[model samples]
Target: MNFALGFKTTMGESGSMEALEKQLICPICLEMFTKPVVILPCQHNLCRKCASDVFQASNPLWQTRGSTTVSTGGRFRCPSCRHEVVLDRHGVFGLQRNLLVENIIDIYKQESKRPLQPKAEQQQLMCEEHEEEKINIYCLTCETPTCSMCKVFGAHKNCEVAPLQTIYNRQKTELGDGIAILVAGNDRVQAVISQMEDVCRTIEVRITEVHLPKAQL
Candidate 1:
């Protein structure tokens, strides 16, 4: 009898932990929510880009009569729960995106405490051609850093090359686009959240109206 009682208690504890895990998990990834957003109808939440990325990655490739290559587009399904979400519904997609963005920003603000370090300080790559110099400039075609001498060589003869700084800036811009996407998603969610608050107020007023009549009776 004692064993049985202990088993039930352990099971109960496990169940509670599972519930907490579900709350933290990303709806899109079915893992911890990286960037969380609340969805409509069910009000279930998910990571913002996770859902959209899943949709884009899995779309149908039905090419009509003449097309040689197939094109895929996003599906309107929640990433975590696999629930069908109607993207066309006014404010729904925007709200979910906003929530995710806000969560990501909050997380970023917390992590920003770690100061940025310079790459050159960390990497110690020496140019093979010029034994004395660090090969910071990269050849585009050869796809390798060359000291001034290697820059004139075989594969890099006509290829375009640039200093590490230029490459860093270009890569940063590309990464910035991804960050911008998250920010945009967050903005949409914020707009809907304001609307949701208004909705809550309306419901409260209606509830009071219903209660007052009963109190009078």
Candidate 2:
């Protein structure tokens, strides 16, 4: 009975992790989302590079169809939903990065590296330089975790350090703000594309109206 329960628990954990990894896969690359993942107006996600490639591939529309819809930029259909995405002069650079997804990927990688250990056998990280001291602070200059002893009287004496929790909080706040700003920027870009498309449609109608009177004669 005990063996069966343990086996089921392990299997459940593995399944959840696999499911999450599947969610992060990029449709264009058929791989996990890389850095600078961007969310389309359609709420679909793609790597920025892959999005740029798709947008570039779509440039032929402007030349072949002479699509006057967007004079300055281009558009592409979303792979997941077939929704169209129009860009500005900045192209993919104007796309909002899905930083939340990126943070999840980073966390997944870090968690994967750590092996599960039984509570009784869990180990503490000790400083290599001060073998007797536990690594309790992070060195800002060297970007390493070190022991208290290192800060006061060791090689890291000249370096600055911070509590690990403080660094974690600061980074979290910064990323949160970035994600919010990017999301807003994305909405505005979409709005601009939509407005340009409308303008093009109106121009086409006016041209047709002028030609219609001549055709009647």
Candidate 3:
């Protein structure tokens, strides 16, 4: 089962936290998976709504005349691996719900809501050549972190330098904007999932009232 983590910037081991958060995001929606997540036959997990969207786009006439049944029997490609997913009469609902992944999302949400604990001061990154100096500047020309000594007389002496704090703040803003876009995409996928859930409910009721009783006879 595929799972993605949703993370907010906080103090302590920033690099590891960022990498962990990236793993939790859905490849299709590029956001945390919404409820009713499903696992494909190929073993990848996608938000049910996102999967439904992919299916509908591939088979435009699948929902024609309000019918859930696919007459011609077509398949949709997986967004990540591009593996073909064959559709049954129930379509997306036929795929299994990934209980493990859903539970992880629930746990992540609970943890994220809690207040962050105070962390110890992080160690400064040191320059290779001038081990005594902390890296405080970014060499724009070489696109690498450097110390003041490097800027003054080392390899980056001719390169333009910017304060590391300035670059950090800019990157933080860009990450925030990216998260916003992903959230917006998730909202759209949620709507599609809702529609598919309604369709599945209708199909289940029909089966119970019509097919089951006739079979018992």
What TM-score would every model get versus the actual structure? 0.31, 0.44, 0.48
Off by over 4 Å in 1: 1-124, 128-133, 141-146, 154-158, 173-181, 204-208, 211-213
**Highest lDDT against the true fold, candidate:** 2
What lDDT would candidate 2 get against the real structure?
0.81
lDDT of 2 by residue, 21-71 (tens): 898899999999989999999989999989978887887543323433444
Tens digit of lDDT per residue, candidate 3, span 11-32? 1244544565676678889998
| Local distance difference test, each candidate | 0.59, 0.81, 0.81
Error of 3 at 116 (Å): 2.8
- Number of residue pairs clashing in candidate 3, backbone atoms closer than 3 angstroms, sequence gap of 3 or more or interchain: 3
Model 2 CA deviation exceeding 4 Å by range: 1-12, 60-71, 116-217
- What order do candidates take by TM-score, descending? 3, 2, 1
Best by TM-score: 3
Instruction: Report how far residue 209 has shifted in candidate 2, in Å.
Output: 76
